[model samples]
Target: MNFYLDVDRTIITKEHREALELNDFLKYLFNTGEVYWLTTHCRYEDTSSVLSYIMPFLTLENYDLIKNIFPTTWNTLKTEAINFSQPFYWFDDYLLEVEKRILLENRCLEKWIKIDLDKNGNNIMRAAKSHNPNLFSSI
Candidate 1:
């Protein structure tokens, strides 16, 4: 399975200023070798910068490896960039109407996590807990 995430308000939110908690969650996902950044900042040449800001606690080596996850969206539509053949969990604060329709049509809506920054601000942490209650116990 693959894990995709948006930056900005979804992972790094106004409610929670720090990303240590989210980084812990993503670090677990990264170990699976299927984590992806599905945000605008990913369009830049240096995609690692996106994760760097949101995952300040992550080491440079790990960040470099993440940057190597080539296929990081640069001017490509997310729907087209992602291969829906494999199961994936996507977390995004905003999804275009067309994108929502496509996911629903493909029966992939269930995999999408809508991160409403205005409400349910802690959904990311909640997702981590749902995956494993003891996952973030140390952090």
Candidate 2:
């Protein structure tokens, strides 16, 4: 499966801290599927800004791992960059109403894993430890 990742409160917490298990979660995603940057920071097919923004929060190894994540460009909604024909999951803290409609129309609304760090602080940790394809099922 392809995994689309967002930054901000999804990987980084609402408290402005990096998730404790971020590296592990990233490792799992990288090992299990293709991962891509699906955040505003990486728009226009440029990843430098996003990489710099996330640098301080990652370990050296994870930083290297992150470099392998492909970049995505979307003119409007992030959903524009998504390949609906493939199996994938999108991890994000927030979703636009229009984007939700796109997912619903594609019959893949369940693939969007909403990560609210404010309420579930251990989300990344739980996902990393779960070792299941449905990482957030028990969250």
Candidate 3:
């Protein structure tokens, strides 16, 4: 399965904080393979920098695979990038209602995970750890 992610509040946790930590949700997605950035931050350098920043949290064995799938730049919205023919997992704190409707229409709602950074707080680091691993077994 392919993974799409948002950076800002979804990954970085804080906009003003220069040094950031990897949250569990992101770690799980990275390990899953072929992770692509879906943020409004379209610069290639910034994307690379964040990937490097989270390096320590990632398993070294998957580093090469992760690098191969990491996008150099992101210029499209997650909703725009999604292709329903292929299975994809989208993680973002702010998916619009219209976007949700599109996913439902396309029968892609199962993989469109919505996360709230504010409510989850720092516990976002533990978010994916407790999930049912078989939840996507059929995918």
Local distance difference test values of all predictions, in order: 0.63, 0.82, 0.57
Candidate 1 stretches greater than 4 Å from native:
44-71, 74-76, 121-123, 127-139
lDDT score, residue 102, model 3?
Answer: 86
lDDT for 22 in candidate 1 is 57
Of candidate 2, the 10-residue stretch with the lowest lDDT total is 127-136
Q: Which sections of candidate 3 miss by over 4 Å?
A: 15-27, 43-69, 72-77, 128-139
Question: Residues 16-133, candidate 3, lDDT per residue (tens digit)?
Answer: 3311234344456666656776766534535566567655544554344445445535344457766567778776768778788888889878676665555555344443222324
Task: Report the C-alpha lDDT of model 1 over 30-60, residue by residue, as the tens digit.
Answer: 7664877788877644565676664563455
TM-score-better candidate, 1 vs 2: 2
Stretches > 4 Å off in candidate 2:
127-133, 136-139
Q: Given candidate 2, what's the lDDT at residue 111?
A: 82
TM-score of 1: 0.67
Q: Ten-residue segment with the worst summed lDDT in candidate 1? A: 130-139
- How many clashes in each candidate? 0, 0, 0
Q: List the residue pairs that clash in candidate 1.
A: none
TM-score for each of the candidates: 0.67, 0.87, 0.63
